[model samples]
Target: MRKMHVWDENNLIDISEVDRNKVINPMLVFSIKRDGTKKCRLVARGDQQDLSTYSKDRQQDTINNMALMTVLAVALDHNLIIKQLDISSAYLYADLKEEIYIRAPPHIKQKDKVLRLNKSLYGLKQSGANWQKTIKDYLKGKCELEEMRFWPCVFTKGKFLEIIVCLFVDDIVIAGNNVNTINQFITDLQNRFDTRIVNDGSPNERDAVRYDILGIDVEYKKGVSMKFGMLESLTKKLPLLGVEFKKESRYNIVPGTPNRSLNQDLDIPCDKDYNAKVNWIQRAIGLSNYVAMKYRFDIAYYTNILAQHQLYPSDAVLFETERLLQYLWTTRGKRLVWKRNEKETSELIGLTDASHAKGLKYKSQAGYFCIWNGKKLFARSTRTSYVCESSTQSETYAASECLAISRSINYLLSTLTGKKPDQILLTDNTALINSIKGTKTINLDPDIMI
Candidate 1:
């Protein structure tokens, strides 16, 4: 009744099958479209009080952005066509394993009769997970596709006419060399589940603007590149967090001041709206963090520092966040260009740095970024657990941390492409570099080894 046809009279059960103990509360979800439209959908999410008691696990995993980007990189290398697909009413295909009851739709004549759902509906906590599992099973059993060992959401099938599927919730992107094979796969999917092919043409020239997916605009001009910063989602999201700006307002050149750290000594003003401000700050950080990870590697270090003070944000933290937004506004059109490398090497290169004992707790804060095939593959910054006795120890810890992350990434890349490449790690600290290459071994704390 809420614009979603999730329920039908044929699917409704008699009074005998109804479980009185299992009562579910349903709500309407109004989702905003990419085209600035809105749609109301019915969700059969049960009572919030009983969430803890729900037996079904709601944790669902999608394809990691790094893995997804690698897949796209390979597609771009082969000059393969990128196509997006949406499963029409994805949740409806998933059958519920547990007995659940939802209130009848408003138009139903029998007010006393509660609808016992045979299939999963939107708004259920476990709906997304259920749908994911169902599709995984179907793809493997019926479609003859094998999921990758490292990234289970990525599916591969066939040899020369292979089709690779990268899944993010209900959104799917399929890439392959053979057009006929890809069309057949889509046709098969359409026969089983309702499918809506989206972003069908060249992403670069479509809609007179670049194509966007997961808040990142993908352009397929000379090569496949992804852009973010100036997305409409960011524009709408920032204002909702009480951030306002004038049309002619100039933004800061940099997101953060050079070598700036959070001022722990600064006190937060005890205003009546302090809690509201904190919530807004947290939401802003969370939203910005996604873009930073997905596309803007330059801002990862800046975002990481801001995130550290999320629990107890001060006026100084708020000011820094505003500055970050200003920087994003100024560099709105920046993109990560993933050009075609003639060598086609999959080697992983790493660069690492550490601010020795610079954190509020006197712990070292480290940052590392990895590049693959001339594109920034991953970037991460974090606070270290161990305190260093000297600068060398801090640099060692940072280098080791960076190496650990590189190993995991290498494993994924190897599993995906059946090739292992040496990790070329780069660091400014000469002592740390020598230590990794067996030139030196500085005495470090035993506890820090872990």
Candidate 2:
């Protein structure tokens, strides 16, 4: 805090002078790094701020998962050099737009005084927006990089867009075909902000092929393939789920079992112990969903099902959640691999399906998988919003949803790679196919019409 001059300690004012409502509490967040280094950050309780005092649109945008996956695929396809960097105390660099006072930390001797913030602090509502604008201006104005229209957090440079920089708040991934060019940009970025290149303990940081970005372990094999996994994250979460393994314990072959009946016992009295168990189940489902969304597509359906019962999970649901965690522990090493297809075609392939009336309340389950040049770009398994009368209607609804998502991804790939890929939406329903080909007319809701 002293180094950054986050607040004016010398200018501390009496607490009675400022509005008591503006005074916020200070928070200290502590964490350990992978390299065994401990770090602490001082933040403000932004939630306590008066809603009328600040704007509601303070949330900042970052690179979405689909865009991140597409960038990875592009890096692998072009054999680009990928490097990661992080800006230390990123939010502290941005100046505060509004006057906000925070109570002094415990270490300070001034118990009756408050510190006026000179800059943005962590946990502030506008801190993320401020930091985002700061970096966006630096990248666009200073670095002369053009921000991609589809993804604002992504920037490109060069005549043919040789360099691509993806920003996830403080963490940055720079990919380019030229090593010296990327390094030069890194140097420029470091000079402007306090930056550190993410080093994976490699002999040369510039030539690092393994990286941990956004909690996903990414390993690149030049032009061969790229693999993404969450082994360390999942391993850490397993113990939190109260899962233990015996030496001779057998593992589950699948994350969940189909056609399993759930205990619909909502009449059970809600006690403290029951509420605790419900919270535990919710946390477990949250972790499982995170893993499934990031790289574990196989468990998406299971996690989706488990999430529905979070409000009032029974012993059966709890058991299934634990079983899923055990399955994850057994297959922790599994990774989502993206291999370079031998073919030089730029195509976006989509596969979508739905099971009618499979979920509770007779709701259908819809899923879709999108592929780009043999890489699994995106996948989603979600329960349908409304119940459908027939399997054909459910399948059609799923295909429509899939088409919308696939087209958006197709746009991202085309803009990044400079090639318009043909999109093929595949479905097992012949009636839907015939409807698309004008051979048959299948009645669909106006909103689901293709």
Candidate 3:
């Protein structure tokens, strides 16, 4: 292990970073590779994910949502954001191929301590791998899966009908521009897995989690949560479990979670000097939740940094995340707005931020945002953006990063959003901006990278 101190370190970099194509998911890769032989090598490998890991004095989800509300506000108006909310079962364990072993839970019932593997558990190592396999297989060639720093895991077919699907364990959130396409996608999905149809008209009203996040009540459930029925009835062409994605909304998922130790500390960041840093963290968290809403993949860097302080962020950290959350709450009613124009075009906008000498570690923070349909998202990823150096050095290095991401987004602008390669970026450093645009004479040497 490396000796790294968070407070005394001289190098601080944004912690979110990821390789979009690799899909580090073990569940998807650990499938039965049938090549005329029986069971081939297990393609997936990773430790199990524990939701309990999120249980702590700090509420990362709440923080992130608060940030998301802001972006959603500016991008969308009083209407337009909608979803097909539905829940078939509480949660189902995923089926697996390998026999990876595991010890029993600390306090749960122990039928047998070291049990074998037949399916995935809340904390199984290959659980995500299996889920990824299923999702990728379902999406294979329809959408574009970006592997670069700009956008990852985005599926598109030249914008005829765009769909953004985010798979989070058992909860799947799919946002699409068209209702016909979304319903068709759901029907096809139900054919593949044991999915409970959502938004069908045969049942009593709406599904739960429609206008709510965890327990915080959302404002626009009709358009955002209850819009699933439009797709359900429209896609009646393909029949699944007796009806289209059924139209039943439930609002009873807020009493308690499997774990209830949350909200112990709102833990507001109370310092005055870190206001800028606080704002940066807020934007990062908001962008992260936005990434979950849209299928954009460039936000891994910022969200990861905000996540580090999930347990107990200082006044410098918590306020930043809170700022972002306020943003999300405002925008929660919005969706990735896409309209078909006679010009046959779309545009992609991006933003990047880097701070030096600001962190307790004296490290720099780097964050970037990718906009699809003017709907913003900081990609959800396992990586974070972090670099150690002086403020000047950190800003310059972050500028280069900003340029790299801009170039990648420029490529996707034509491919995904249908607009020209022109992008707008916002940053606090004028020197970095000038350096990136090549309009100012700034030192950009590799040896001097922070």
Candidate 4:
């Protein structure tokens, strides 16, 4: 889905379980890696699979590719991500040799006059290719050529340095160790794709990166703090939970090394960044959300469920996310400052409660809340309790059954929070608690009762 983004991210991604939206259709996500690899993935519903495909036309792809690559390189050079840029309305930054015509999306009359594209945008084919040719040509004169691998793009220079850019038509990823090389690439890209630069609006360097150094409104999240250590962005190579998610693969071994197969050459494009990932707005007080925990916590909820599937997520499930950005914006200057005897002890305590009636799953809903030192978490479960059976039997059986998840949550919470609290587990039926409490007693059921 190579389309233009229409809504503000703060407007959508941050929204909780329930919210409404005016625009809800397929959106083209144009994410070009800093190196230059582009990816086009659909963001439509499960049923909309019928309407997905890369733009077949050549002209559109050409312009978008160039504009995107040009802008992408600029972003990398300037060290910007999830920032904003406004395009001049109806601007087509393409230099086209052939005239093209189009039928606007259904309902509108086909224009007698063909829309001439001077720039690339949502719809077009060769646009990306043309733009890439334009940028590549401009870069040819400026950047010193080093080394590269195709299919899943990879480029290298000195001993251990490389510039890897993946191109999904125009959504690119550019990664390189040489600051000069990356910067020159950006300059050349802009020379071809006219993008309005907005780095000037960034904040002064005094802001906090992680909230803790100072104080964050949301204590759970800390303000990002900046440190001047050298940085490397090694793309994570997780087991392809769903799709191959081709992006990166093993590097660092000699070409003739025998363990070649041990490290699967990533089917995904290979690219990495050598630049320091400073605070949100380039250099600042904070850092990229804890280098690791970001992805871990993000995948926590889905880990078990997704691991179960093991295979690829239906094409509908390629990971496309901006939540981290939303999270960034929301907690831009926040950090979880851990202080000893800060008057807050990290202790864990818990309580669990269950109901008598659940739904068709024939399960009861059991919920638990954990309080640790200073933090708290609430979680619940239903599905793991009962499989379906006779309604009368299920109702009474479910009523007398208590899900055992509370104990597991209590233990995990204790491990994290450190503050252990007495757990008061509760269930609606007294008989249920007795059964668990008195597991030693055998009360064989002659018949089920409501």
Q: After superposition, how far is residue 51 of candidate 2 from its true place, in Å?
A: 2.1
TM-score of each: 0.87, 0.93, 0.43, 0.28
Candidate 4: which stretches are off by over 4 Å?
A: 1-99, 103-111, 115-121, 145-147, 150-186, 196-294, 297-450
| Per-residue alpha-carbon lDDT of candidate 1 for residues 272-359, written as tens digits (9 for 90 to 100) | 8778877877887897788788888888888888887875667678888887877776565677777776675666777888888887
Over 1-450, each residue of candidate 2 has an lDDT whose tens digit, in order, gives: 888889877887999999887788998999998657899988899889876545788779899888888888888888777888999999999988787899988888788899998888998888899999999999988888888886769888874447889999999988877666677788889888999988522423544377888989988877788889988877776787777754344546788767785636645556768888887888888888888888789999889888877776677887888888888888888999988766778778788999998787888989999888888888899889999999988998888788888877877777777887878877899778777766436533222223
Task: Give the best candidate by lDDT.
Answer: 2
lDDT of each candidate versus the true structure = 0.72, 0.81, 0.40, 0.31
Alpha carbon deviation, residue 166, candidate 3 (Å): 3.0
Best model number under TM-score: 2
Off by over 4 Å in 2: 200-208, 246-251, 263-269, 439-450
Could you arrange the candidates by TM-score from highest to lowest? 2, 1, 3, 4
Clashes of 1: 0
lDDT of 3 by residue, 157-233 (tens): 32422544434334444544666766776777665555764433222254323333332223333223221111222
Cα distance off (Å), candidate 2, residue 15: 0.6
What lDDT does model 3 reach?
Answer: 0.40
Q: Where is model 1 more than 4 Å wrong at Cα?
A: 1-20, 47-53, 56-58, 201-210, 222-230, 246-251, 266-271, 439-450
